[model samples]
Target: MIASGCDCEIFEAGPGRVVRRARDGRSLEREAAVMRHARRHGFPAPEVLDADGPDILMERLEGPSLMEEVASTPGQAAEHGRLLASLLRRLSGVPAPGWLQAAPGGPGNRLLHLDLHPANVLMTPDGPRVIDWANAGRGAPGADVACTWLVLATAPAGPSLEGWRDGVLAAFLEGVDAAAARRHLPAVADRRRADEHISAVEKAEISAFVARETALT
Candidate 1:
């Protein structure tokens, strides 16, 4: 296995492919469909090859994740942040299909990657490609940005990354509608709080972030 996340494992399938299988026996068909749809709309999502039951075969993305890049070279945090902002902008341009589920904040006609963070982005030879579409859905573009903001603002990090997080987040929000992102922050906060995978420490960080941000309003 190449890597494993909270509920899925990634395995090398061949020379240039990988298989992502869920651990809980849930079907990955919807996730596969979402990736294909995003790709069809010209987004930089990984190309899906085949999907059945709990496994999805996809083109292997080669490179370190954006998080790795920033962590290794802290000076590049702002630049990578802008890159993430650009990716989010590109995704916002893609029209959401009606069959997709609505995102947490509310319903809208834009593709929302509810977990778009540095770790989910692969800095590939071609460019940055977004991965892990399990939480994707349709919603207002601001909702997607809000989710990223909440994560960047609160997710647990090592001492090395803790200080740089704000730099990356600031650069990312500079290009997007900060007001709109703040508008959706509360909804995103609630969603994160209820996620079963969130650790207690992370939940406390999230709550603290929410209180700080909300007080400024």
Candidate 2:
């Protein structure tokens, strides 16, 4: 993929994943802090081998990504629904140090991986490895779920795509405050404004998903 943005080339590697700096020193430091905290709390994630400015060398994961696995299943939607919820819950339980984002940004007291999506999850032989902590921070847990729903809703679907998006989304909303989680467009919109740029269509889809989930919940 082409680079240059909020964090450019941020991923240079010598053998495995050697660096992740394109984002800058401050970004690298924050990510490193989060990674270290995750590792300490036993979160299945990459090890920060080194962190110097925007450069962050990381341990390479040795396994298939969740994106790859999802391609092979007829019931892929269901599988992803189950996997995403369980993993996020586990991540929430992992306590970061006091210096980290200790307080929730809003209602929920759980830590959130703002960029949670299937692409960031690697399905290793041992278990799932959550990657890409660039957008991670302390926030309501529902924000994370809202992000996931946005992913499913906005992901490209060809005429050949066979699964039901609604079912997959429902799978994601099976537990907790599924309704309130869906109606989090304002939060999602705010997040997009502060960080990455989600497409207008994608944002609209997210808004719709948020509404639908809110209604169904």
TM-score of candidate 1 versus the correct structure, residues matched by position = 0.96
What's the count of clashing pairs in each model shown?
0, 8
| Candidate 1 lDDT, 19-111, residue by residue in tens | 999999899999999999999999999999999999999999999999989889998888988988898899999999899988877768998
Give all candidates' CA lDDT scores. Answer: 0.90, 0.67
Q: What TM-score fits each model?
A: 0.96, 0.79
Scored against the true structure, residue 84 in model 1 reaches a CA lDDT of 82
Q: Whole-model lDDT, candidate 2? A: 0.67
Candidate 2 lDDT, 1-217, residue by residue in tens: 2234555454447566646656444647777778878888788878888777767678766777676666665467776777887887787686445555633236555556777777789887778889888777666666777677667776666544456565566676674455556556556655664444556766566566556655665
TM-score top scorer: 1
* TM-score for candidate 2, residues paired by index: 0.79
Could you tell me which 10 consecutive residues in candidate 2 have the lowest summed lDDT? 1-10
Q: Once superposed on the true structure, which residue ranges of model 2 sit more than 4 Å away at CA?
A: 1-17, 23-26, 101-108, 158-164, 175-177, 183-185, 193-196, 214-217
lDDT of 2 at 145: 71
